[model samples]
Target: MFKKVPILIFFFLIFFVSFEDLYSKDEYFLTLRNEKVNLRQGPSFDYPVKILYKKKFLPVLIQDSSDNFRKIRDHENNSGWVHISQLSKKKAAIVIEEELILFGKSTIFSNPVALLKQGRLVKINKCKIEWCKVKTGKYKGWVSKNGLWGLL
Candidate 1:
């Protein structure tokens, strides 16, 4: 019994420390996992649905959490509660500029493939100094980093 005490304490400390790092310190970026999720006024299903998020991989700021529910703020500054299960750790970004040109490569000389309007959501695959490789469905290209949000 005495020999088991130190072993148990060691395991408990390891578990606690790792669990502490599992959640965000204050605010962190999370993405919508499903194509559609319901945002409610409160942390429980008893609350009425306040909005419907139909965009998958949309970046959202997690401001608070209670149990399995998390309070999130969208790019439009809308606040609501969503179930944590509907959220993913994948990072994404929203186009903040009124209009942004999606380039074929990460340079101004690259051919423009599409024009992304503001509020458009794209998964951030990687980023460089002033450009980010983004994708939404079949649209994959680079966009100026200055026009995006949800990155550090």
Candidate 2:
């Protein structure tokens, strides 16, 4: 029994550190900590354009980096970079706070432009700067990243 105790403690320590990283998914999975935040035009300290963001509304968490700007996507599927000051610790998933939003593109491997005639439900894969890589079931492509909700 004494010999097994050391082994068990080693396993426990390893699990504690790596286990938390397993669910490091980014989305607006967190809610805003404060009532409101300023939506800036760019992701740096210099760019300070005041865009309107709702109070307590969650914004998508795209990526965590060394810069103060945290990339996020909006409800329209439009992706952009926001200041880190706009974020909150409260984590959550998106819920339909408004009406049903239609997708503009369809799934066609050869005819991407033609397929995007109507809207559809998309599963987001990830994001880059201002573009969100998403899959509308059959079609995997890029969208503006503003179509989906932040954390609900």
Candidate 3:
């Protein structure tokens, strides 16, 4: 009976901790699933649309969540509410500089693959300390972490 009581207590503690973590209001990264998503001034559709995001896979920082909407900040530092269904868990990033050189390798001295324009949305494959591997269409390369948004 004593051993069983200790095991039950351990299981309860683990469950409670996991549940709290699931509901915590922590900031997270999300990508736009659709090519065209509307950012509104408020959580509901009744609010006026403030911005139109035309690029799919654009990463946004989720600041808060309402019943069916999420308050998000884009790479351009614009804050608006978007429908939750428009967001996806798939990782992605947006180029923040006027232009960025994608390197075949992680370093600048390495071969340049392409010149990516600002606001280009790319799927994030992985990230290191100073660079992240991204892909858009047929191009896949690494961009400096300094010029990207949504690397956390």
Best by lDDT: 1
lDDT tens string, model 1, 1-152?
A: 99999999999999998878775566888999999999999999999999999988888899998999999998889899999999999989999999999999999999998999998888899999999999976899999999998886
Q: Write down the worst ten-residue block by lDDT for model 2.
A: 106-115
- 1-152 in candidate 3: lDDT tens per residue? 89899999999999999988877668899999999999999999999999999988888999998999999999878999999999999998878899999999999899999999987878888899999998987899898988988868
* Cα TM-score of candidate 2: 0.39
Error of 1 at 8 (Å): 27
Count clashes in each candidate, considering only residues at least 3 apart in sequence or on different chains: 0, 23, 0
Q: TM-scores of the models, in the given order?
A: 0.76, 0.39, 0.77
Q: Higher TM-score: candidate 1 or 3?
A: 3
Misplaced by over 4 Å in model 1 are 1-25
lDDT of each: 0.92, 0.51, 0.91
Cα RMSD of predicted structure 2: 11.5
How are the candidates ranked when ordered by TM-score, highest leading?
Answer: 3, 1, 2
Better of 1 and 2 by TM-score: 1
- What's the C-alpha lDDT at position 104 in model 3? 96
Output the worst ten-in-a-row residue range by lDDT, candidate 3: 19-28
Q: What's model 3's TM-score? A: 0.77
